[model samples]
Target: MFQRSISYTALLVGLFDASAAVADLTADRVWAQTIDMIEEAGGSITALATRDGDNLNISNVRFTFDIPDTDETVIVSMDGWSLLEKGGKVHVEQPDYQEIVVKVAGQDDVTARLGYSVRGDMGVYSEVEDTLIQTWDIARAEVKLIELIAPDYDPAEATVEFVLSMNDAISNMMYMGNGHQQSVQSLGEMAFDMTIVTPAEDIDLSASARMRGLMNEGFQTVNFKGTPDEILAELTAGGGLRANSALDGMEFKMEGNVEGEVFNVSFAADKASSNVNIDNGNASVSADINDIAFNAFVPAEIPLPLSGGIEKIAYDIDIPLAAAPEVQQVHIGMEYLGLGISDTIWAMFDPTGQLDRAPIDLIVDLSAGVRLDRDLIDPNIEELMEQDPTQFGSIESLGLNELLVSALGAVAIGSGDFTFDMNDLQTFDGIPRPEGEASIVVSGLNSVFDQLIEAGLLQPDQLMPIRMGLGMGFVATGEDELTSEVEVRSNGGVYVNGQRMR
Candidate 1:
């Protein structure tokens, strides 16, 4: 179902991309440009256009597209939409309701119908030289699942329903020459709800999500003259795409019943933001969310409800998309700060409260240098890899700038740098040989293990091997503290505390 939803979304985006080719404010020009754009995108439109003075009434509006890389086709049809030339602007009048159908050609032959609706005006278009500007102030916009049919599922016995809505939305879009486009949009609230039922299995599932104060902005350029794959190649090569978005708060909840058992889950976050940039055949993305809380209840499993919270959750990554002669730099960082579980949950295993209840935190920062023999974003990458699997890419160097894990009255921190001999793949089980050293420090390890044993979470028999391993590899630095210096030689030998391990 989620995959179907994504396909539907792609179809909608394709529709918007098809409509971004407005060159003049006249209704006839707008109509002609829309048809041309649709055809250029490998799509077809069926509509009767009638000019009543300056207003163009389009009826029986239907659009069909064979989605690339899939055996599915999408059809969107509406009855009473028009483009009116008012003064120097073109007003877009969309019908209050429309239906979209998706047909999948396969063994099952699935079909899905989606209903879309708008409460207010869709937008207004005005051309400034070669650029077309569209502004919209809409009261509400919504999409809902109308029907779904699939093999082996009886509609009378099983049913699914879904609805997505946005309210108090405003947007501005600019379509410039040379296939450049920019857009900014804001919404007061957005929400989605889905429910599924199957009587045969006695199953019922319902999920809902909501977001408030959402804002998004994006810019992209495309080569429309090329095929879909070619266009994607051009964009990833250099044309580039960028986007940013933020939300004040968001929440999700789910409840389900399976064979008389019931379960509930929910999570919420206070604020979140994300951004992405793709240029020069390289891409970077970063996202963060703060003040997160989660809760779950399952009577058939745990008798008590479990709850947890996190102060912040974030990650950042950058990577090269195209081949480069010189090695390109890559980075990845992640953080989960101030995470805590309810005492009720902890007490289940640690009835004596011997373990520390302090919040757990984890942090990791890594960077690498990679050389790519072929473009990672190439459409034929998979085929190329199949022909010569080892010619794809190689990691030449890696740096672990920071690593931290703190929980259960224990902490471990480490950092390392390594250079890899990509040409040698037999030394480390078909992996590149590495040469570097990493230093790690662990504190309160014995205390934490003892507490775990007391809580019966760790058996005494399990401690012997762990202790033996630590004795062989780690050195005692202080009371309840252990340190290790791990090194990998160019000869593929590994050593810990000057003791050869491999």
Candidate 2:
């Protein structure tokens, strides 16, 4: 019995070893697929990808891309690449590059000593489908753009450092028989810092963008209906682009500065974001900045600290991508939510200290629903754009939802819902004529003028002329309220505030 048990144990050990070997061999097949993908992406890769024990090592890897119909070519070479499988997960890493070269036909080759390193984790098998999934975290990546064979870089010369990183990034790839579907999600940041120096000027710029709460809500389909090269050609010819993928939410920001001997200017923003629902052909984007600022330092000839900015600035845009005339709507709004000046700078212009120091508020909101001739989200967009840019996007009708502006303790709001006469474009001098009535309501106009005069910013003589103009164009609707009505008749006559203006 003891001898029989020993034999059985040996058999089990042999079976386990055979299974492990098969898993090791699978790496080579996967690497072949990766190479195919690179080739599909317009690059040629040459390397010996092999598995060593439980790890795969690709040695002396070289990748190259040539610009079509041009002598420009980009080449990237690396010494070592590695991928290891453990605990049902694959980990990937690559050594620093030996060199990177960009060659143009008639210009001196631009080259750099490239450095790259990556560490990522990927599941061996998919949990959702019979596909592959990868979750990667970029440890560190930097490209030092410098001249080739330059022993040392000059501090004053132009130099750029581009850095990218990710905290948690996940990607899913589903391989159909002839095509593939993919989705990517990440939360991280990217930064680009550059310095340029010359005999005439010196400039330094640093920009950083962060992305969080990001998710590609749907899988993007890459149809391989024909050969790889054929597909690539079609895409390059602007024949195959489509909107098959949708993103849930994303935010971005870019801030930098320019400095020189004569002037220095700094500008920055904190927020730019998008929320997309492409399935329903609905999307909204908002670019907002709180505490965004701009400041300039220049020659003393200006005699003032030239600095001013909006404390809050925002623009919101909404669109229906695939809807037609009756259902299509496009909305956009811009607002200087808060406007302000520094006390030191304000004091330069208002030496009497009579002006209000508090920041002012301004808001402008507008939206319009329009009828369209075709779907805006059609996949074959290149053909449409090439035929006639304006003719393809003809507008049939316009329904103004709201037009609002509030500032300096006063408000003005108006709306115009009208149909456009496309055939009579020449009547309105190239723009389609509108048949509608628009009305604007203004409040606190007198009070606003009084405040400006009290602050010494407006003289009484100037205020009187403005008031008289308002009296001619607007009617008093209520206490401290003014109403202005504008009408565009079907016969092309125009009226303003119950008076014939045209």
Candidate 3:
């Protein structure tokens, strides 16, 4: 639903790109250019246009278009619009209320009404040489679902509502003749609420989300000469997109009833940010969230509510897009720091408090060299995979740059590097044979196990085999520290601490 809303918003805002490479700006010129742009993008617009001095008044405006790559059609209608030209600048006016209807083939149709108010300038357009720029400021904007028509569902039997509101938003958009477009936007606060009630079945659902201080910047190149499908194909073939966004804080809450069972869930984050770059058959993405908390309650499943939190969480990845005979570098990393559960929940498992209730931390960083035989975003990838499952790619090498896991008075750290023999798949049971060595150091394992035994969480007999295996595989490095080096040879031999195990 959020994605659909964004698409609708984009289409509506994109129509405001009216400035052309003309020396003098006029209301008629802007209107003509807007119509041309819409037609070029495979859309149609109808309106009653009238000129009143230097102002152009348009009424009964309706725009219709088919969404790319989907079986959905969107119709946007507004009661009135006005454009005024003064001092080489065109001022674009917005309607107080607009209606948007989405018709999905073979599915229910949804209708939404948007209401907005602008404080200063709604939108101002100006052109310099072959470039056009638009600036806008909005005081408040809102969207509410007005109607939904389904063939199988009776609207009278159920009640549904969806509303999204934004406050204090500003945006700037620039279009260059070289088919490049860039936009930057900042919002003070945004909130969404949705609810559904079915009286016949006695079901109720509600969800709400909010975000504050959000800023986003995006850059993409357009192919004015190509059709929508052609442009999409070009994007699939590596027409790049670069975008980044950050938010000061975000939170969400949901409550629903399923099969007579009630559930409640809530999540919040103090800060979050993300970045993405896709160019030249390569892409990289990274995201970070700080001070996050989540809680969930299911009365029938678990009597006690479950709750957890993390001081910080991060993830990053980089990969290739196109096929290549030579190996390409790929990377993936993730981290969770200061993760802890609620005391009430933790006490359920460790009621005696024999184990330390320290927060857990985990970190993993990995890199690999892979050779791709097919494009990662190939349209027919599923069909091709059915013919040859291994045709997509093969991993040549993998390196674990860093690994750390710490929890409950115990810590483990390890690092490893391995190369794969793509031709040999029998030694590892239909898997590429791996040859490498890994070293792991663990501390406080015995102490933790002793505490667990005393806490009645584990039995001596249940852990005796594990202790014996550790004794044979690990060497004591410190008072309670153990270190082990495990290696796999090319000839299917396994060694522990330089001693052959298999």
lDDT of each: 0.85, 0.57, 0.83
Worst 10 residues of 2 by lDDT: 1-10
For every model shown, the clashing-pair count is 0, 2, 0
Q: Model 3, range 361-386, lDDT digits (tens) per residue? A: 99999999999988876767788989
Q: Give the TM-score of candidate 2.
A: 0.66
- Which one wins on TM-score? 1
For model 3, name the residue pairs that clash. none
**lDDT, candidate 2, 84-203, per-residue tens:** 766554556555443444433324455555444344443342212233444443433455554543334454455555544544444444453335444444434434444444332345
Model 1 compared with the native: what TM-score?
0.82
Ranked candidates, highest lDDT first: 1, 3, 2
> Which parts of model 1 are misplaced by more than 4 Å?
1-24, 33-44, 65-74, 95-117, 142-163, 193-207, 222-238, 256-262, 422-432, 490-493
What would you estimate as the lDDT of candidate 1? 0.85
Which candidate comes out best when scored by lDDT? 1
Question: Estimated TM-score per prediction?
Answer: 0.82, 0.66, 0.78
1 against 2, candidate with superior lDDT: 1
